[model samples]
Target: MSASPWLVGPFVDMLVGSGLAYLMTLPLLLIISVRTGFVGWPVLLVTLISILVSVPHYGATLLRVYEERSQRQRYALFAYYLTGILALVFLAGIYSIPIGSALLTLYVSWSPWHIGGQNYGVALTILRRRGVEVTPLVKRLLYVSFVLSFLLALLSIHVENSNHVPASGLQAARIYRVIPVGIPSALVSVVFPVVLMIYVGSVVGAFVGLVRRGVRGWPLVSVVSLVAAQALWFVVPALLFFWSGTDAEGLLPFAAIWISAAHSAQYLWITTHYARRIDPGIRTGTYLGKALLAGAFVTIFPGLLFLPDWLGAPSWAAGLGTLLFAVVNIHHFALDGAIWKLRDGHVARALLRDDPGLAAGKAEASVGLGRWGWRVVWIGGSIALAVTVHEQFERTVTLSGITLRSLDRARDAIARLEWTGRDSDSDHLVLANSYLQAGNPDAAEKEYRESLARRPSAEAVSGLAAVRIQRRDWSGALENYDRAQRLDPDNVDLMIRRSDLLNQLESETPPVDRAAIRDLQRRSIRLLERALDLDRRRVPTIVRLARVYTRSGRRRDAAALIQAALEGLEGLASTERAMLEREKRALSDPRSGSAAGTRAGPVRPGASGARP
Candidate 1:
């Protein structure tokens, strides 16, 4: 027997460097981490690659907008809508959590559609390049397959919690009330298998036709490989993550990171290609210029948006920044979803101009199987498919039950708090956090107040302060922070939070209040300084204070503070040590601004606070 030939041309030119292709490679790479019980270098490398690739793609899109008047007009409307929505969400969040939570749920639901749609688009693009005509039936099947995969992934949320294991350790925080779309999980379960079976049958039929129609060579191989990759890479993860019960804890992170990276890579490939192709002069000089242009695009949002947080901006500013990010993401999804349509004559002509067959207007051909082939597929595939589907269903239900129970427990905790009165500050604090997650800031405030009344606890005071910050009651929040500081003067975290809010207030306030703004900034600096004085070796606090000093135009103080933070940090991991150096450079560099380009680099949310 001969080993299957490993083809390299398609892997290099079409698949590996692009979105879906990179995504398909995830399962193979993750095997090392899964077996070894730790994520090694490969995971870290891919994550970095994903972040780097993701931004350039956005830049590519923006470059097109800058060059093309039509593109600008098309995108400007979406940009305005996104801006308006973001402002609404920010203002709404100040009043109540429910409205913001509802919008968040809507965005979350739309995300899978956006992601899956992109995958489907990639598949179509691949087929078009191969000149493989897809009938409406085949198109429907492809769409269904991608949609089903997303649905399964959605059902798989909190799979670890289903087994009584909280992966990220915020079980309460995760138990928010998401308004169900009224479709029963059981109904989705029943329909999913049928749709999946049909999708598989259609894919198999298509592959058989490709072979029978003498579609051999790289084109044939590419299409087959893509289908196989989608099945193994996409479908399997969705089913396992959503439907599997065992060892899901080990699998979740790998899937999340890989998917994210793949998505970013894909965006970069398509958008960059589109931009360069559309506007030949966009980067006519050299590859370096193109790279720089893409970098600028990547930097625009990430660079400025995270400034408030980096300077220790209050909860409202951070929340507003978060809302803006979400809005941009949602806009990206919408624009991408609408703009790329291969079936449209204009789009097909524009994107597929190089491929005459793909650009040509021709009727799609339907491919079907012979009776014997259908009989074989139905009989042989039935028993095997049934067993697999049944097992998945059982696992899904068992896992889903765990999440349901967690939600029930959360509700019970809230009810108990209501009945018992705020006797236990700890329990009230827990319930308060839960209420906030559940989108009930009013209840959270009541509980926090009760807790504070029972005891002048720093935690309760801070919690209340946070609620006020979210409500945009800056004075109230600062007053609470002051009280909390009095209660526990040595609390570094509280001081940092206070400083952050103060910095945000100073930056956001009008130029008319120069004296007031200066006073606020000075107060922020003092807060951070006091915290640092209490614990000089605290790297996080030191870095934070450095940020405040830089913001206050005290570059020398900022550089000195960053230098102090970097001391005795040689024992830290390579990444951590490298980050400290970046901070030092950012502070010392004359060109680096407080909120723009900094030595610490772009403040990507969810990254360690070292950047902030």
Candidate 2:
């Protein structure tokens, strides 16, 4: 007997299998909403979706592997040995950022390909079910199109966002601190467009081939929808990044959230179908309940058990979670690949046809646990899930408050988190930044010290420097700034800040002490020149350097710098352009002297004068 053309009919298959047409458009719309300030609860929403949809999908794979004794024995190497290895890796990753980042890199690199592979399998299954002969040429064409799509998306992510660092709170940005994997912009400029064109052409060729081979109706719709979803997920965003010449930091998180949710739902839809068909006695709810629990157990429970102390530290938690996530996904990818091959006679018989031959061997009897023992197990699982959910809820509130800039709400959430013993270095740093923004330099300094005590990062030291600047402890501020620069020598912002401080000190020096003033100017000049060397397009650095040149009696050099800035005026913001024009006028007027860019007093940290 032939297998049904549709799994649970056309509507369900199209909605779940193709992951709904809206799945393609929703990410773009949501990203726009977030960017425009229309959405404020994105973190909360994505977290909930992850708990409900994404986590359970991982459970589906576990159920497929260990639910039956015979299946467990068949895949023992993966189900037991490989899982044990991944567990050890996870433990190591909690302490070592490099190991954790390597694990994350593997998962990130493989994620798109895994999505493409699944879609490719589904499209082929649909075609076969519709009675279309899938020739080797047709298979090759489809395979190439999907692979190209994944490559296009992957390249776009690395290329377009190469220079854009996300907010410090984000997981990607945190990992990038240890492992910088950004591709060069010049290479992205050359390669992305070529790959995009080839991907588009391959997709079109595949569609035409399918049509020529008598593919029609739901099968064609499914294939077309899958291709469109791939494009929406990967290609369109890349195109947007390429066209706008902006970072994808705003869009990437939303895209990842929705795409993962959609992918998980699609996986569950097919896997559940397979499970029910292969074992007629299995109820859908029972199978899904087990899958959900198993998924939560593998993904969440282990983290809680092994890294209880690290949960409060967002940096450590994020890294550990990333490592755990990578391990689970790698295992899922490997096991799913092994079990779901259409080339396997048993898999083909079970999925492509309603054949019970695959289930002829009886499943091993359940462990003879008494009712009380079963009840205890369920109770323990429930408590674990409840704890996980509550932790997630607190995290969501804190992250939401941060994203929305609701300082009061953020403070309250942070307090609650710390009250629960979840206080972390990152949390303290965030509090310090909040205090700084609120103009409480003393409080900000205290928080910064607290953060540094837990973990000494450049950001924390920089925050302390800013606090000292606010208190007018110039020598103390310089000390902290020097420490910060030592931690991050290549940071252009730090170079500019230190230069600005020197310029302020020069303005304070008595005119009679020309040598001392000149020495300060020279030091400032060297710092600005170094900043310019690091980033030639940094207009602020160029403008600042020109001001120093005018003060140092290099009127010709200053005028030339101002002229170069004006030549690229179109790229400058209106304020930047106005500043440059004023500098040009000052350079032309010999009587203007040091009035053009000299600060009368110390510029506040993050003020226009400090940066400009």
Candidate 3:
């Protein structure tokens, strides 16, 4: 290969297989932001760019499917649209928030598999293009790399979320409900390393086959590039986010942006190639043609499909915005799967260019399970794996109530496994809360302290403060809250909690010096005022803050706060409105003002006061 091709080949492959367009755009955008000293606009810019690149691909595919009736049957195309409409209707009319949440969960869970499938397909395509003969064992190794990596990544996330993993002996026994077989949660925690090993093993295995059989040059490079790209795209991103110790939930949007960009680019590359092959005169490869087509499809089509989201009405309005968006995605997945059949003659002609070596490789891959014994074993193993996963999930759901006999076994196994680093701050916060719920204040306090030592996280500080409050360490609680407020001063909940904590301290303390007590009460009023400034329409905050104001001889401010809350209470539930009304009544009534001040208690941050 020429030096230019050697240098540029990997990048060219990326453009066709998984566009690094967003990757390129993002870094450049960040550089500009650094220079200009404005970060928010870049975020919006990147979002718009992602939508422009991704939405068009979906639109273009649907438009092609609709316009090119010769490539696809009429009924099939009609049914595709019908399915989307039905999905939207179901999502819009019958879908509760819980149902929508469930669907979103399912979508997120399935996404890794879908993305992995694409990566595997691209790898296979590269292997074929480079004239590498893919054997049955080679195919299995490749598939295992993708499957194991995806599963390990998924399981790592699960373990992080639940923090309870069984090791090899008893814990594994309890977890799997099996003897002599076990996979430890600690092993799951090392999923990143395991995934790397699998990918490396597959690459080594492929290279060894090539060396023994005397295939070198571009073929070896092709295999390596495929493996490297998969690692860069999937493995590295997951591990980077995982090891960062921040909430992995936040990484979803980042993953979606780059993954969608890759998927769109790959789909467009192949589809445009097919289009060019079918009709040379149509010229989808040209800049203007692509722009006009992609632009038109984006403008005219998806808007009509996703009009509900665009309406921007209230939550109670006749809108299925989320449903429509999700329906389009699911429908797109199904439609793309059905349409892009490489086995078809036209597709094979376009993709394979009638290469006999590639064709033979494809045949060998399909014939892997021709033997009945092998098929039986494969089927049995798959069914067993599925059952094990299902049972584990069921156990997790009922873990709080049910005590499985084997759980002790699993716990013992988990306890024996050696951990490497300290738990993430988020994990510590979660464990602290869980310990608190289980009536273990000591453990909860320790976890909170450990979390704070690692990072001055607002959540951890707030949790630590709450623990101090439970232990009646009033000064300690106030100090923690002050530390937390410095970290996240705008967090209304933290402010309200601190304000309430001050009130509780005041109520519990006997008045040694009335002036000192009044100073403390004034501090509470200021904290609540800051919270109100941050979130003007929070009725509960208004109520609690108003109560504080009334106690500290600011009844006029309390009355004004109640009036402002009432003005913004249109969409609140009846109970919520009623709660606010009670606050309104207390503040308005001259007789109850003194009573409201003396009857102070801790406000539960996110919840309303109980008839006080």
What local distance difference test score does each model get?
0.53, 0.71, 0.54
What is the clash count for each candidate, in the order shown? 3, 0, 4
Model 1, residue 8: what's the lDDT? 20
What is the alpha-carbon lDDT of model 2 when measured against the actual structure?
Answer: 0.71
User: After best superposition, candidate 1 residue 544: deviation in angstroms?
Assistant: 42
Tens digit of lDDT per residue, candidate 3, span 1-612?
111222124665655564445455555655655576543333333434434555556655654454444433533654456665655654443335445534433444455566677666666665665555678787777777777656654554354343211110111111011121234657655765767677678767866766676766655555555555555455655565456654322332333444556666666665665555455455554522343344333322332333222343112112232333444555556666666655565555655563334322222211322456334433443443333234334334423232334333333322221021112344455556766655567877787776665445778877877777666676787798888889987888777777777787677767676786687788888887888788776777777878878877788888887777778656877876887788887777788763355546653421111122
Write down the TM-score of every candidate. 0.48, 0.78, 0.48
Task: Report how far off residue 189 is in candidate 2 (Å).
Answer: 11
| Per-residue lDDT of 45 in model 3 | 39
lDDT: which is higher, 1 or 2?
2
State in Å the error of residue 373, model 1: 61
Clashing pairs in 2: none
Instruction: Give the Å shift of residue 598 in candidate 1.
Output: 63
What is the lDDT ranking, best to worst? 2, 3, 1
